[model samples]
Target: MRALRALRPVQEPPARVTRITVHRPSPPLDGLVELIWAADSYVAQAERERVLPSGAQSLVVHLGNGPLRVFTDEDAIDATEVSGAIVCGARVTPLLIDTALGPTVGVEFKPGGARPFFDLPADAITGRVVSLDALWGASAHSLRERLMETSSPRDRVRLLEDNLLRRLARSFELDAALRLSLDAFEGRDLTSVGEVNRRTGLSPKRLLALFRDEVGLSPKAFWRVRRFRSALRALDHGTLRGAAVAAEHGYFDQAHFVREFRSLAGSTPREYLAARVVGTDHVSVRR
Candidate 1:
């Protein structure tokens, strides 16, 4: 899902655009899904956009003209079209999105929280986008149809939540150790992976295994993503230059920060800030 912030639209969207709505799920569903959002934008001003990783995975069901197409590389070559209802896995690299607009309703899964929704281990699809049909078969198509048939955003969110609750896969459970690890690693900038292992009383190898099984990324890797997010937050809300931001986020120095940010976000801090689409992690760019 998009970050939790008030959006100032960079430009007026086309007349057909639906106002973006973000809704949080209730109770048990809230534990897994961070937020459900719906929006309609039939045309994109840019040919392609680079979406930075949010660490969490998301399931998006298209309700408009076409399915989402993402490019694997910066050149915008070799684009692959995913299903209308697809699950995007936790990733470290930027997603090169073809901004051909598709009205979409999406669910953002919390860290290690998507395990109960899919039969396979979370790590199985890390850094990749997989169709829900591949996991749920005909049920996925049915769910999308129902979503498309619903006009109200509220009804659509409720329908999606009820479907997820019913479709909960029992194959994997988020054990206590894994839960504790996520708690320790997520948003705790000062907490080291070693510290988390110590707190959980698990060896590094064993802990990493748990993280991969449930969280789709190693604890250190997840922490790195979270740190990048924190840096982004700081940059978004505060006036911090690269060196200051780097220091704030525990990088060795500005150079170290630049390298890591480039790896994860595909841009230097300044460039990313300059290109960022207000109210979103997407960096606007042409093909």
Candidate 2:
């Protein structure tokens, strides 16, 4: 249950880390871990990046980096400094992250996937970032020390995955109804709440309560983010017009798509795409 399946990571450390490519986790942790991603010191310039919501949470490990700096808003008020490993919660809105740092690694958790390990409601940490040491105590600090000494990304991943398996909850079990709802919501384009209920046979109230407890975001909210991400994928994969991309993703209209884009991305589609840095989500913005 604790063994890693295999490694097929892309060997391009110079690129910004977007998705996991190496050291797939074992079966026991599959429902919890969606991916494992890492990045080297690709850029040294002091800059800010907009981190859009992915309807998932993450545990980020800073390997010998100074610290992870996060701002509540563009104004950078009450910024939080995270050292070692940190748990990044679900984001209902875009976030401003300090991009003036070094190499890092992270584990992206699937929707409703983090419940078993933390012994708390998923919404407790949603839209917030908490240190791993705060959650896992001495074990987190020890893991960071081991990672700081190892230079290989593979070793880091192995260590991370092994530790996660060790920390796997023995008493908790994944909700069956939530899995059906997630599949229904993610399987179709523009899946409606009613459709999800029809597929899962759960009342709207039950669905909402389940999401709040198990997944942080409500069912409808999670589906909205999923739709937004679909549009992002379409845009990334091709050179399509905004209207065309909107249609492909089942947005109500170009105007509606733009509004959602601007709301979650902190910029219009044109602006974000035009200023996008190649091979990464980081965008150039004036400080």
Candidate 3:
């Protein structure tokens, strides 16, 4: 048998211009964190891009000149400046972000897996880019300061892992029902959310409430996100996109898939593919 690989590089910044490295946590953390990534580079001009939803939560620490700016939508006009670090809540909408002026480190937490690390309910932050200081308080600033002192990307990544380990809530535990539902859904059930609900042994209302608290998305929304991820992966891999691909990913048909794509991604499938930055979910948009 072939040896198993740990972290797979999802995106490689344009060669020579910028470099980004992604690492997967080992063991316990692996169950929650999908990956830890760091990027260091400087662009003479401001770069803006739209980051598509991945059905996950993110915590990013910026260690550079200017603060991170998140735009309201695809227009890229209205914006909010978020200094230092931010917790990007699990969302179904696209996030428009301004170019980074300095080095940055971030963590991508698996769906419903961020509970232990956060103090509040996951749904509270949904669709919002919250300042990390709001949650971690002064410690968030101190963490960014420490990251800024480190020139080595490897060192920064290690620091992030250590901080997460220190902050991990040992007392927090996932509801047994939610855990079971996640297992079934992630196992590629490719069926209906109703089936997943039944498997959880909870009423539809009860299970939905649990999901909102833990996963930040309703069961149907979460399933749609998951299905979208699969379709995107297939399309990115050069698999021809059409009704066949849609059915393979559990969409009712090509039209059904297209509607969901527009809703979550803010663009049609073809347009997204044309603008997609290779190895990343980022789409370059005109200002």
Candidate 4:
């Protein structure tokens, strides 16, 4: 199995549009791709914005004091008024322009990373955007205030993780089937869909449906993102050559990798890596 590692952001100056502060409780789950902490201080335009590439899903927790408007490529939604904390569930790549007031703090958990807590069938949650207040049966605002009051970042993260796990446990089982499947996909060559189905005892259709419900994308799509993340981490750590990384991760060739990377990451892998080297981090929303 491949050892899990952290991808540190380049410590350059912050970008002009947004400011982010991140906290990590521990190294991310092995099959999980990425995790991020982000905050914005002002409202953004309603114009379409590509927040993340295809295949990945995100969860957004609002720590602001104003309402947030979430717009997909085709629709606009007035999310809960930001008085407290709200957790947006998994979603495919879509335009997420923040049409709300500033001081928005949220965490973005990547595809595999989010799967541990949210392993449900996509149909169970189709077209439903839930407020954390509704899900927690309390005002999100109060919960967030309590969380923010904790001074220690580590403590805060542990608290957040505990809350998330508790909430999700009410809906899904946290057991070996999901954990082992995640571990099987890490670092080794990509496994076939049939093999995954056999090991997990879920039909391919059922597996994809469940993944989408909780994680917000199909299993095959999730696998691609996981592989992409693996290559990106290698690039970040300077541990693999470009071609070697591409071939090892199951890309047909370097061009195939580049095309897939650009489609999902909104830029070529090299360009994205270059930007990361300069401290332009990525942001994603979870509606």
Candidate 5:
């Protein structure tokens, strides 16, 4: 695959565009996905395909003058002149859409990376489109628009991070616990959920509940997905062999890895690598 632009967010307008901000993964977060941005004049006909990996979620903020339509396997949502937010959770199918007008700034948070921002059960979102006003208040739309209007990309990122923290403040403590457990698992195979609970000083049941609320997925599911992403990045970097990648990421073996890969990525490692070369404009995936 082509060397991805750095993980930092980029602000650049394509032809006939006013402005666009692309947010990449953070350096320490090499396993996450990239975020795309489009300007008011931006318009594209998206293919009828699912675009995100399992456990992934996206938050979109509309900053332009027009509206945009998002199509899921079952539903189509028209977010018009809605200078607000929309959250897309893990979908079994892809979203197809034809943009009419306006600029849309979005943040694509990968499986593990997005856990801290949401404090609801992962399954709570199935394949549904929700407005920011539905989650936050009416003022949320205007606030998001103002932040997106910031001229500086750095300022925009800071604003985004701040907003994320604010929205997830109730779940911050749970995120802290999860981060601690994740760090404990680094450089070693992940142990049982009970161990994670012990390390975090939370009961296993409480941990699961908190994790599901804050991160959207159960802790075990989050761990598995995060490990999968770790393996994917290693393979993407050409630093780990398939068998070794599975072992290193806490999979029982290559078979386990392949199963999880197929379930989450819809392909095997080799096939995913092959497709990765062709879909350079978007995020990487492992089948």
Candidate 6:
């Protein structure tokens, strides 16, 4: 038998490091959390990271580095840097973030995941970013202090999960309601809001209320993100023909898809695909 050759683990470069890490939450969080994750990058120059909407809200801690500048579709003039920890509201428009600030670690809550924990309605913060302290009060400030004491990324993540787990709301059917609302969205099985209400056995007003309080974006808006995400995926995979992609995804026509795509993505499908960074959700920026 030939001597086995030893294989060395491939190491990612240390300097100018860019990375994304996702951690699995224990037990009960599995249902509500899509994944608890962090996005980190270190480089001399600023990176324009285009964060697309997927109908999820992010609970972010800047990790003592950033004040990431954020711009929206409206102003394109004024930019805001979120301080300490921030909660990003669910949005339909693409968010332009300047990542020159520093590394960030945060949790991207699954749609409807935020409602159970916060007494405030999810819609209250839609299309906005508010400090964690505003929602979690003293605990948010304390968590920041604890996280700063640890240099290890792993420790920071654990600290975040621990704090949130301690604050998990008492078990209830809130999860069930959220699940039913989302189920109608799975695979575009339900066509419209009325269809979701009918399938979920929730009336129009009740479903609307639940979505406003639990999911931030209403069922209609949430589905738009879902649909947009799907189209982006297809386009990224070299769909080539925008028309075919639209038709397959249930868009009324090529024009319809283009309009909707630009509405959420801030660019035509073709333009976006042209600028995308391969294998990642983010688009490429000129250095």
- Model 3 segments beyond 4 Å from truth? 1-16, 42-46, 169-173, 187-189
**Model 1 weakest 10-residue run by lDDT:** 3-12
Lowest summed lDDT window (length 10), candidate 2? 1-10
**Number of backbone clashes in candidate 6:** 0
Clashing pairs in 1: none
What TM-score fits each model? 0.90, 0.87, 0.90, 0.63, 0.63, 0.85
lDDT of 3 by residue, 1-287 (tens): 00012243233344324456677888678878888877766342236777788777888888977889898876657689989999998889888888655788888888887888888889999899999999988989899999999898778989999888888745344567877887777655458878886777788898889889988988888888878888888888877677877788877788998999999888888888877666556776755
Give the clashing pairs for model 2. Answer: 9-21
User: Alpha-carbon error at 81 in model 5, in Å?
Assistant: 14
List ranges where model 2 is wrong by over 4 Å: 1-21, 44-46, 169-173, 189-191, 277-281
lDDT, model 2? 0.73
Runs in model 5 lying further than 4 Å from the true structure:
1-57, 63-84, 89-102, 108-128, 144-176, 185-188, 277-287
Candidate 1 whole-model C-alpha lDDT, 0 to 1: 0.78
**TM-score, prediction 3:** 0.90
Q: Please, what are the lDDT tens digits per residue for candidate 2 over residues 61-82?
A: 8875588888888767567888
- Model 4 stretches astray by more than 4 angstroms: 1-11, 14-59, 69-84, 99-130, 147-173, 198-202, 240-242, 277-287
Better candidate number, 4 or 6, judged by lDDT = 6
Instruction: Assess each prediction's global lDDT (C-alpha) against the native.
Output: 0.78, 0.73, 0.78, 0.51, 0.55, 0.70
lDDT of model number 4: 0.51
Model 6 agreement with the true structure over 175-228: per-residue lDDT tens digits: 576687787786754567788877778888888888878888888898888888
The per-residue C-alpha lDDT of model 5 at residue 120 equals: 57
- Per residue, candidate 1 scores C-alpha lDDT tens digits across 1-287 of 35354232223356223355677777677777788776644344477878788777888888776768888887857789975788888899988887776667788888888878887888899999899999889989999999888987667877887887777633334688887877777543665789888888999999989888888888888989989988888888877877999887889899998999999988888888777776666786744
